[model samples]
Target: MSDVPPPWLPEDIDETFDPLEHADIEPSPETPLIVTPRGGDREVGRSCYQVDTQHGRYLVDCGLSQGTSDKFPDLRGLQPQSIDAVFLTHAHVDHCGGLPVLENRNLLADNAPVVTTPPTASIASLMLEDSLKIHRRETDGSSAVQQFTSRDVAEVCDRFHTVGYGGGRIEGVAPVSDVEPAIFQLGNTAHLLGSAWVVIQTSGYRVCFSGDLGGRATHLPDMSPPPESGLLMLESTYGDTHSHPSLSGARTGLWEDIERAIQTREPVLIPTFAIGRAQTILLIIAERLHTLSADLRDRVEIVLDGMAVEGTDIYHEYVEDTNYFAESLVNRVVESGETEPFFAESFTIPETDQDRQKILTRAARDGTVPVIISPSGMLTGGNSPRYLAEFTARFGNASVFLTGYQAANTTGRTLQSQYQADQETVSATIDATPFSTDWPESSDVQWVHAENTGDSELKTRISFSADWISLVEGLSGHAAQSGLLSFARTVAPDTIGLIHGPDYAQERLGPHLAENVAGVDQVTRSRRMTPIAVGSETDVDTAVISPEEIDSTGYTELEDQIDHLYELLSKLNEEVASARNEPGLSEAEIREVIQDEMEIKE
Candidate 1:
């Protein structure tokens, strides 16, 4: 629960400066809404935007881009003190990674709390703390010193005001002497844990911000639709193309790859992100294995390592207790007679050094293929590299399957490209080694085994050439072209401001939006840090229509159907209660009756 005031009425606001109700003071003239992109306009990373109106100045996001010399958002020529509020959509580094920098500079106003969902508040804290550790290691002696401390992350947590999606409105920035107070509401974007689509409303204007929107439902909830507004700020991560495979297809493909690896006794390495991607992969593996051959399924071991283990735990906690999912989905989970999905049967959470040693040793020695899913998907850092080094050398019985995007110039991308080149005996050398002797500059340290600890200083090497498979299915978090267009139609805003995409993506989407998307007057392809005029025609009807008002009958019918199902289930439960008194009734009979009543067949 956050201490921030819920939707403040005119009376609840400051008595000294009531912009809405003071008859004596004339309302401030509507200023042309100025949007300045400090980062993430034309580029794909470091997303930070400043939305300045006559009433308030708000920051949608502040983040750092990976694989760039200038990672942090450009904060020059901007006064952080002037900004009223910071709203974070999700916990991903590209969206919320630059918070520590802002905090370090004391840029945020004291009253302006970092506003976001509860899950995001928790996950962001974890991400920021982890980022701090990573930054400290990389920037130890470099000119780019680590900016914020662990204490800064703690302070961030303290300042977070957790609000649920589609809940009561939370006041963003307090109304100043003349500026009107901006009110904000969050809705699920289905991108990751606690990802949200935001709508901000002030007098005479409304704007919607789509922060990393997802199209289809995953293990998590489906994306909530953004309300129609005068101005829509949308993400175009995959707007250029619509070639992503379906979730079912991606799962089946990955399962087939794993099955082939198992048949050949080849160790399969699944490099993935610690959060959503890793958890989704685990569930997919667990569910798909029921159809697999008994021998192959029994032989496979799913080893969970690195930060993914922590992320999975967090996911389970929220999914079980909170409104993190749709009401219908939550009801289904409860009615299905299972509290949690069956994942523990195959997944292994190794705790100690000895436990990890057993997994690695068994993977190398046995005929059974171990599917090792490790973190740091890009191969820039984490346990995935260690596993890649260990297994990639054995070309005959090893495979590295990438399950996400590989950023350019990253070690993951390099490996992906090298594998595609069909070069024999490909070598990957790591600089750091356990042994501390000064080796010659020309010598490559070859790490034979993780446990092999001799006086010899050798670089970690992958001598054998193994072809790496890049699986894009179920990999990306952003919505594809079809999904984007669907969202655009649902919102039907007057103007669209596109950001968070490459040049080609925006180019393709801009034309599509102009011709096909109705009610859109203009589709602007945003560049870095350029102020665009929006909400100029404030009189235009841009207010979002309530769905209840339009489709009350359809909504009622759906509710009636759900109620009917519950009634049938309840009757089945009553039968079971009565059957308990009879000795002849069996468990199979009870289940059969329940399924029959529910119109389900095995």
Candidate 2:
């Protein structure tokens, strides 16, 4: 195994080939895109977003949710049988977790288009198989059932259309939901390697849905915004104030922290986000360890805890597939000693539980020393939590190093808590915030938007041969602030819908958008499972009027209505408190109810 390279990257390389054009599905304008509930709703946790259009409605993400089925309804009451496709954004569970569920149910059987980046298709299947093992263990053979099986995942993969950054067009499927489809493209959003901003020109609306956008860009690839846009569905993750600060001080700070943690001889646990962030840290670890002596390097063992290692394998496999993903820096981990930034040994596990338990037992030993890198970055759920439980109290010298952004309500956020896990309870400080709820809130949920670069071409590639300098000091992803302004100015849509983030950031950004910023229109965000009237210029006098039924407060949850066993919109908005006042419906019913509720929102 050590002598051979990953089969995906054999010597017969095809660097000039583009994997995205594998299939060129075209579309027509008559299709109307419909949004469905895949996950990510008002309740928090889990990320599922679906888009349905005439070209044949499909999904964007199918994240596993934390809240009750009553709370996170399927959103689209569409009969599971009717749904046509599922587009995976990245391998993260929040984005791809729900996919297995769709497969197990055999929803859309053979018909649903499983669209994704080549890398995403491979990595997601690997991650899901791992997740199934965890679920099986946690649920302990409960007959309740699981979301997906490896075979089902394979089935979906068989149907996948590999679309690379701006490769253009969904294979066989049209861009419009209900209508004939035409060419469309994917832009690199850079949140994760395969994360994208899907661009489609349907009817008259040229929309670009921002997948998670990373803060800055260097080795990572990102989606370039369309040349012109009628509607820009931008992400607001960083819609608030600036998300990541200047890279200027980030690296220096990271080194100082790492040095401090290592000096104690305690194992420093770096909880890494599985996707791009994990790879970034790996290279950073490789480069920084170069300055340390052999003595120090031997003591600093690096463990791959989260899905990142597996993800890295996928990224490395696809390295030849994309110009943007590079792994030479990380390949040096084993030889790192004497060379300065040497890590004792970096491990990519056997993808088995006994192996995991072995790693944990070793981490808890008396003389074992090192740094472990694991995924499930948010800590909502992942191998990192188990590691945290074993090593948190063992050594005062030991520090849990958070290497990625901590999302809200996740375990990663708990790191910031003054509390340590005490027995079954967390020992929060006297001044600490008390959460009587079953789980703690996520602390690392910070934000950063990659600035738009206004760069695009069918066959364009950038040359980057920079050394792996300090990582904390690096920030690049979203269009630069200037890029955003320029994109806004050029499109100058009569009105642009600035959605995806906190309300105020959108408000502030809206005003800051220069007047010349092309047809910039009204800025709106769908913070809740609710809707606001969408008005058109010609109909300005009447326009699309908001439903008089809106509660204004916006926390409305419509009671489930069954129309011939199909869920449909209802007039009465039930208080969430009454979410399950009625019996929790079966998965089939929830799927329908979710669809019904969203229709009313539109």
Candidate 3:
């Protein structure tokens, strides 16, 4: 091979040219808006994006990753003191969990405010406090260092600048001299109690961020249409899925599962996300409680536990706020004269260990069919695992329903996989409290409390039959592929960057948008640590600096063809494996079958 520089490189560039040496250059008013994906580029958790405009630097969301070692956003190259503001979209831990870490690491400026909606601020207070407790507990006897303290969480909350939906000029952000100030607006996304999509205008450019879009929830108002923008950064969490089962159908399915469990006199345990899913499930059951026979309704017990109790309280506090809720909910609250919209007639809150124990004992001995709702939906933390251990070890016919997305490596995902594979039993190692007293000798459960340590590390192993496991679908808070395409068309931006999804999903959605959505000149799947620059008149420029990172947008036409070949080969391999089980199937037959499948997928 001839020793020559690639034609794409600048003619003056040589080995002596260093990119890092010029990294300290300050951005000027003429510089294009630069967006760096610190996290949530090709993954679903820790959704943090760093945007640099001529006016200032800002973050869309700083969150923690669930069920992974890389928990916090990659903030290595960022200058903490230079951040002008942080815009939070909602109160989900994956979206807002890392705020305290910014405070702890001094990554945020002293005067920079965290701007969000009022309901988000209220719900985040409870979410952050509960998150701190989990953080302390998880790091107690490990080499992993604690990220933040309760004091740091309090400091982050103190900096919250509450803004309502619609347009407003952001104050307190550092501005460059002789430049226009940044303006912002929040649009209701109906993903959660106060989730929103944010549009920020600065330096003669408007950028829109779809911070976890969803519009199917009936309790929240319909999603507001986002204004047109020069560039749109959209979330692709469910981009591979064409559509979701209707909400009403999913609710009916869940109710049928619960109804079957009740008739069998079995205790039902539902592990749900504390903020949104928990409240939704509670309301679903409450609305149907009166339909059951009077005796059955009187005998059933609905127990709410963990952080969900506090989250539901915050929901009630905002019941009258039109910006946070839909008209149907407010009217129901007013017409029924009920202070708590989520509470059922048999609602019970377990305040202490004894209270929880009594509920468990009654279900075990008296055959009381208590329906339990708890937090930490992934079964990674909170009282859900503890309750799971107790129910698995004590009751033979108990039902455990997983509600919402179960991230990789979580106990919920493990159980789900085992059940899908038709396994006889599911086993998981969980953290729980040791029993206060010994159970009957016939039980398989065992526990020994350490003499000197607190109750944090006392309890241990649990095993359950797969027959008790059920996964309730169609409860996600993210939009599917069709919704994402619609949102993109509404904005009708020149460029679209897909973030907060897996590589496979982004791969499928990118081409769909390029082919279906008009006026979109470029569709790029965000890669972490890469900078994508957007300018007014110039084509979108993606700077590929790291050798290990894959350029999602093929740099040349030949590269695009090679990437497509690899994708087809991967699909063929999967088809071969699946066909191996078919008896007497010829290789040619298998190839024909695979070709048909590929045609349908395309």
Among the numbered candidates, top lDDT falls to 3
Q: What is the lDDT of residue 118 in candidate 2?
A: 78
Q: Model 2 over residues 67-131: C-alpha lDDT tens digits?
A: 21211224333444554656665666656666666666655635667677877778777766776
Model 2 C-alpha lDDT versus the unseen true structure: 0.47
Per-residue lDDT of candidate 1, residues 1-602 (tens digit) = 01122122232433233221222222234534555666777677778887766656678888887663437876654554666678888888888888877777677777767789988888888788778878777677667766677877777667777888874443433324443555687988878878898787766566778888874444556577777777778899887765354444465568778878888888888888988788778866765566668888778887888888877777766765445754443554577655555253666877664675567667666766788888889877777876665454333558778888888866677777776787654565554332123221222235443325554545465555545455455556777766676677777977787889987998777766655567777777665544554555333222223222232222232232333343334334433432342222333454466566667666
Per-residue error (Å), model 3, residue 167: 2.3
lDDT of 3 by residue, 1-602 (tens): 11233233345654343222223333455444667776787788888888776667788889887564438776655655767789998888778989999898787876788889988999988888987887887788777889899889999999888888986765544333335477888999989998989888776677899999987676777789999987788999888887665555566679889988888888999999999999989887876777788767766789999889999999999897778887767877787788687888778899887898898888777777899999888888888887887776678778999888877778888888888899998876665753335443425455645335655545556677888988898877777777787788898987788888887898777877776567777778776655656664433344222212323442333333333333234334433432342223333444456556556342
Report the Cα RMSD per candidate. Answer: 11.8, 20.6, 10.7
Model 1 has an lDDT value of 0.65
Q: Is candidate 2 or candidate 3 better by TM-score?
A: 3
Name the weakest run of 10 consecutive residues (lDDT summed) in model 3.
Answer: 543-552
Instruction: Indicate the residue-level lDDT of 566 in model 1.
Output: 37
Question: For each candidate, what is the lDDT?
Answer: 0.65, 0.47, 0.75
